[model samples]
Target: MSDSNTTHFTNPSTFILLGIPGLETAYAWISIPFCCTYTISVLGNFTILFIVKRETSLHKPMYYFLCMLAITDLVLSTSTLPKTLSIFWFNSREIDFSACLTQMFFIHCFLAIESGIFVAMALDRYVAICHPLRHSTILTNSVVAKIGLAVLLRSGMLTLPFIYIGSRWPYCTTNIIPHTHCEYIAVVRLACGDIRISSYYGLFAVFFVTGLDVFFISVSYTQILRAVFRLPTKDARLKTFGTCGSHLFAILAFYIPALFSFLTQRFGQNVSLHFRILIGNVYLLVPPMLNPIIYGVKTRQIRDRLLQLFSRKWA
Candidate 1:
């Protein structure tokens, strides 16, 4: 293996996150919407956590997975948005190399964890609908705990290489990352060496995490649909479908933007930089905001409990 440091270039100690390239003049104006989105995401995820904690009826296998998902979303959004907001509002974009790496690690790790949680939730739905009698037995507290730990470990293991490899790469080019945060590919592109290995590893990591989770989620839902359609009565089918509506919407919200951004990053080289950045931000922000709303509206138990909680407060 060649020494990564032998490159004839200077590696800067810090990086400048160029939030939304060419839109520097509109940073203040743009921050308003970004702030609103962040605010909503934080509040929404917190509400979901609070409701899950306070409501006894929601203490089930499915809601436990929802709580995990909410926590992941909260962490993922918070990991980047504060720094991004600081850049937009105060022009504080300079980040230490280690800090950038840390942010990048958490951003990708939480995203992977969230994806894993989505798969778990899909599996929960599958077992509930397809194997109702065994759902509780299969997804006990210990089982869910194990699954969460496994997901965290998996995310850490998969993402550690990206950071480890990146930390070793000679970032001798301009330390200006043309996005809101130090994403894996964005930072990797700054290195002044043959980055094909790191690039392919990053691609492999994204595909391994998102692709496999999506595949499993799809399979779970396919089995679920088959089971749902087999219900003897129309009301049974509708009621079973109602239970899954939130998860389906959550699946769509989480995966669509993620896959879009991932594809754009890979294939859309000619795509507008601004559009790519916007979609990346959308992937970061939208699901966290939409998830709680979807669950609050579509999940009947959550909706009734929320109404009851608010009504009691008003009374």
Candidate 2:
């Protein structure tokens, strides 16, 4: 542990975070790549949202949930990426306690939102498959609106306590978050105080948001699969699977890294820092880019339309 400091755990004042050994690296070189990732993630997600909003033909419950997801992705990615880029590229990793709390708050809230959004998508698929005739009634405009509102509320209430708990704790001298963002568990782990309460909250967050959401999504898909097997034509079956494939792809891209790192840390598996870094990149960077590609651009009709729109505007 190069950052193995002799600093006391009690009455801590400042933290020294071990950012990716880029203090010696030139800022200009790091900034470029950082900016590029940030730009692409933001632009891609936002473009998806914009096209969904502007195209009235896409006003179904399925795409409505997708638009909400795109909004969540944009918020989730922005909550951490820019700051991470600055830390790596500009060597500006020293985050204030208040700001760290705030960042952690959004990160948690948006992540919860993202998780719920996935559940909502799974439910959408279920209705589309199981109750095709009454799908409109079940997945109505008002219902979808309420579900979106419910997602925000669920996410907000779950994370609000963590924010309050984080604000009250004293941090360890080394403030550097191991991963790029100030996640609740990682952030509180730096605290020198009695972390029993913090750890409990972290566990609660894990079970409440990630674990619960994934559970429901799995349940939703089980029902969806049963319904899928009963579809009349092979073409109908293929189309339904196509709708779900995008969401599942995005979910795997986001969760795989998170699960890997969390398990490695909790189980005391001697994971390498380099390996952790790669996992962190997969968690943060890949989903934001690939999500748009899967749900938006790869949907041939949407891609062709967007390209035509762009060509018309440029010409």
Candidate 3:
């Protein structure tokens, strides 16, 4: 029989995901936190979706954007967490070539979706704060629906090239991916051929998509702060700040680690391999786990609704 580990095809038959190199001995212990985070991510995002759908009072652009965000987090976390847990809990790390590419595609797609949703949310905040009178007229239900579709299409189209180019690469040897998930950069690094194209494109996509979103988010917040400060009373300023606190926290939670991971991988060559891998995993895990909590706690409406939900259950 042919050696199961060796493959004759242009593409390797399977890729082994190395979940946290030098930490295999502690996978059992490490799985505890990962499982807890995954549980919270699923339950929290779904609760946001449920509450938003059930509460017709939340049928507005801001809430709609929150719904989009919740959905993206749900998909993004689910895309990788299950497999990651399998590796940690059961040592099932072998992923087929096509499956690996598919996972990478969805991961990138939803990541871009989340970033686009953040931009939409920023724009929603801008309109609500800066152009209060026109906010309703501009971001009507139909308009919000159109924006949702546009976000999906834009993410899908832009991320297509990532997987397309990745699929064509000649991954002849060293199929072990030294990370918990099939990250774009990690997987590409395993390719036997020249990886200049994949590397450059990944960088371009990161900056073009995430950098643009961060820039717009910054501009939106600047305008929002100006508007808030101009309010006549301290109470008015506090109220405006309160309304935006959740989104600001969400942005920081997602981007800070993401940027750190990217920069460390690209420039921090002296950084330990395990540290880079850990940061990458944290970048993927943190946002999904924290976004719902941030919104639920910071937004009074969501917090009140959640309280009412549990109160009813208890009663």
Candidate 4:
């Protein structure tokens, strides 16, 4: 393990990814699950996009947000999974400095964007359930388009600094990262100089994007619940909450694992390195795989459309 005191380079051309530091013997086995995850995530998200595009009845603000979420998930998983698989299956770990920064940027950027989409979806539900009469008016096509653009711009602008800082920083300590992908913190840890700026900025970005998003989502749901309970009948309450079931499941699916992984990565010093890495991989892979499934199962419209499409092919 090379440290800051080791022979340093002003600018290294490439960095080595170690896949999983303590799990070398199981790389082949690990690749199997990750391959399956990537395949399912791609197929599931694409299916969602296809169904949304082809089904006119489904053209609503909620589905529009779902489409945005699907696209973000596609990019988020793609940015890391291919390279991770290469390292696991073929032992190809060398990544160009520029390429590493690009991967890092996309992974983090799409993550923030995905979080923003969840907040959008939550607000959509809040309006639908809380103010059904004005939901359509409030979340107009133009408004949704502006929200999507804002998400993209916000994530890109915030994440660009990570790339800029990573690129300009002198990597004198080492070029080898112990994880599967080129994470910002992992890369910066190799720098020979003080890394307080990078560390502080990363924490700030996380709180600014994810923390605020989570707060908004929570508030949306709280208002939704208040409105839901005000319904006159038990059946009405159940039916109203049922509409939100899928969104709630999707939120837990994405955030629970993600929060765990982030906490373990930052503070779980006693946790096994491989365990932390695996959790990180799970947060990235599992949500993409589960999002479509949760929506398909809990959403009658999507489920019916899926059945119809499959039936046509079979017939």
What overall lDDT goes with each candidate model? 0.85, 0.74, 0.86, 0.89
The residue-by-residue lDDT of candidate 2 on 205-272, one tens digit each, is 76667788888889988888778778899998888777777768788877777777655645544766
- The regions of model 1 sitting more than 4 angstroms off are 1-11, 242-246
Residue range 1-315, candidate 4, lDDT tens digits? 656557676678899999899789998889999999999999999999999999999999989998998898899899999999998888999999889999999989999999999999899989988889998899999999999999999999999999999988887757899899987787888887898998899889987997899999999998998999999999999987887766787888888888787777777889998998998899899899888787654678998999999999999
Q: Taking the tens digit of each residue's C-alpha lDDT, what string does model 1 give over 40-145?
A: 9888888878888999878998899888988888888898889999998888999998898899899889989989998998888899888889988999999999
Best by TM-score: 4
Query: Number of clashes in model 3?
Result: 0
Each candidate's root-mean-square deviation in Å? 3.4, 3.7, 2.4, 2.1
TM-score of each prediction: 0.93, 0.85, 0.94, 0.95
| Arranged by lDDT, best first | 4, 3, 1, 2
Query: Model 2, 40: alpha-carbon shift in Å?
Result: 2.8
Candidate 1 deviation (Cα RMSD): 3.4
Tens digits of lDDT, candidate 3, 166-264: 888877546888888888888887767689988898888889998888999899999999999999999999988877876798888888888888888
